[model samples]
Target: MIVAVASGKGGTGKTTVSANLARVFDAEVQLLDCDVEEPNAHLFLKGAGIEEEEICIPVPEVDEVLCDGCGECGAFCRFHAIVSFGAKPLVFPDMCHGCGGCAKVCPRKAIRETGHRIGVVGKIRADRVTLIQGRLDVGAPMAPPLIRAVKARMRKEVPAILDAPPGTSCPVIATIGGADFVLLVTEPTPFGLNDLGIAVDMVRDLRIPFGVAVNRVGAGDDRVHAYCRDQGIPILLEIPEDRAIAESYSRGELIVDSLPRYRPLFEELARGLFDGGSPSGNRAGYRPFKSCQGRFRRRENGCALELHGKTCCGLDNRCGKPPCEDKR
Candidate 1:
């Protein structure tokens, strides 16, 4: 099972929860930190030397010498990465989507595909968890590619937890794509509620199962609980605001180690997601509610049952059609 721990805004203890949960479960787990632009999970899991691999993206490189100054390449590019205006074509590598259409349409074959290093993916093992983190090259505008590379390291049979980048954007979507469930970690502040609403909409649109974890539970008002109750979304777990927990976190100690009692809480979280119900029950097999019929599910055939009326597998599952809303 793949569970992605994410927040609409940063610093809500998403990484803390992810790391501790992996430790408490003690299963063959993989922790993928998909926050490519700013990866800090490695700091929490120290002494794990990350094996690095370069991440590159294809970019169009135009050979002016072979060009007949044809505008076919320019006209074919919808992103306008390549433009021909009476002279040698100008190529904007950053704007390119690497579709290869420009090269395909070029009569002289002047355009050739080349790779540009965008980031690096590192695999590190600590205890029972394998932590994969991606670091984007400085000034690189793209993050989805690196996030994809980080996720590619995940072993499907093992329980994997992805530390997603904060905010509802392409990077976040990429990170949470194949997750069986998403745990949105939030504080009880007004900003938290506002951003949580946006994150709820994003996950709802993707038709993924989700639950909420209220961190620093007593720091603010009860509005978050009120919203969750109103929306019928489950409040999975609550982490109280404690100075000791804060001090331990500051000292790079795992929550399960600092507060041994809370180890069961993290383990319960894993069970709740995998069992598809509240952790306080008889531990029976989980059954999805009728209302959640359209949510994504992994089939026995190793394919994903997308709500878009199609079964998909591999990376192609990413492009499955959007969910069709039920008018009822």
Candidate 2:
């Protein structure tokens, strides 16, 4: 089971919940800090044997010798990574999404792909929890590619927890895209409630089973509770506004490690999420959608629910598994 810990905003105790949850599971869990731009889960895990590998994305490279400046590559590139009026096309490495579309559409095959280093994926065997995190290179514009690289290293045999980047943006979507369940951590303040509502809508749109974890429970009013009640979203865990917890966090300490008595809360959360049954009432084997091109298509009976792409029947697609590799 893959549980993605996400939030609508930053500094909402998302990492705090993720690290504690992994600690309680011990060696039974694999923690993936998918916030490539600002990965901090490792600070709490602090395990040894840290190894890292440089990650790169393919960017289009033009072979001027074979180039005819047909402008097809430029027209094909949606990101404007390549542009040409009549001469050899100008390639912008930073703007490229590395889809290889320009090379595929080129009439003369003048375009080739070259690696552009964007980040590094690090692995740390921290005690019981295995920490895998992606750190984006300074000034790297895109993060989804690095996030994908981090997820690609996930050990499918073990339950994984993805510490998603804050906000409901592309990076957050990339991290939580294929998660089995999503745990949204929020605070009790008005800002928390507002962003929580936005995050809730984002998760619901993805059709992923999700629950709420409210941190700093006593810091604000009951508006969060009221919102959850009205939305029928379950409040799985509540962390009290304790000063000791804050102090421990300031020192980069795990709450469960500092306060042994609080281990039960995380253990119960783990049991509720994976051991007994998911809040969605579906087991791990149930994958809601199959892949078709770059999008996900849910086939039930004869109807199809296309996600993140245009609606289409399964007829034209050789639908097999999720996260369909775009061959375009």
Candidate 3:
């Protein structure tokens, strides 16, 4: 089973669930920290021998001497990584998607693909589990390539848990794309509930079987529970708010290791998710939902839904609501 642990917003304990899941998982497991831009899984699973490899992407390199500043390359680039000023072309490596369209379109054949280092992938072993993570170079505008680099090494013989980045964006989708199930992690606060709704929309759209794990319970009211109940989303587990959990996290200690009492809780969560089916059998886009009493509703060829008498993205995110503050 390949499960992607994600959240619609950051600081919702995605890494907490991912790391602890690896620690307690009964079978041989691998953890792929796909949050390449800001990976922190290493902080907790430290002091392990790591095998590191560099990850690079191909970027266009222009041989200025042989080329006339033609505009074909610029026009062919949908990303506009290369711009032509009459006959002089300027390349922005950061913006390049490595499609090689510019090089292919160059009339003078002056463009060549060059290796550009974007990040590195590290494989570490701790407590018999493998921890694989990617670290994107600072200031690198791209992360998907590095995310793919980390995922390419997934151990097919064992179950894997992907620690994805926060937010409902490309990076998050890239990490969770092929996951069999996604365990959405959220807290029990107004912000948590709000983001959880957004996250639900995302997973439903992708059609992956999912359940919510309410972290930091008792930190807020029962509104989160009410929302989940109203929507018929399964509440997989609830990690009550605890000061000791925070204290242990601050010191880079695994929760299951630091608090032995919590071992069975995570173990239960692991068994419940993987027991449903194998990765190949589960697809994120096949699940059913309400509001439309079925699949996402479409009006005028665009996705839309009504919630609390308000029309918004079919995902039910209260986008117009005021931003969530750091109540914690």
Question: Model 3: residues >4 Å from true position, as ranges?
Answer: 276-328
- Tens digits of per-residue lDDT for model 1 on 1-328? 6788999978998999898877775456788999999998887887567589998878888898998877888888888989997567998877776678988998888889999888899988887778989999898888998898888887766677899999999999999987878889998899999999999999999988887887876677677867876687766666777787899899999888878866655765665555522222211211231132222223213221122223221111222443223210
Residue 174: error of model 3 in Å?
A: 1.0
TM-score of 3: 0.82
Error of 3 at 250 (Å): 1.1
| Residue range 234-276, candidate 2, lDDT tens digits | 5666777779899999999999999876666676666656653
Better of 1 and 3 by lDDT: 3
Better of 2 and 3 by TM-score: 2
lDDT of each model, Cα atoms only?
Answer: 0.74, 0.78, 0.76
Per-residue accuracy of model 3 over 1-328 as CA lDDT, tens digit each: 6889999878999999999888886556789999999999988877485799999999988887987887898989888888987867888989988888888888889999999999999998887578999999998988888998999999765778899999989899989998988888998788888999999999999998777777877677767767776686755556767798999999999889998766655765665555422433223222422222222222112211111122222223222322122211
* Total colliding residue pairs, candidate 3: 6
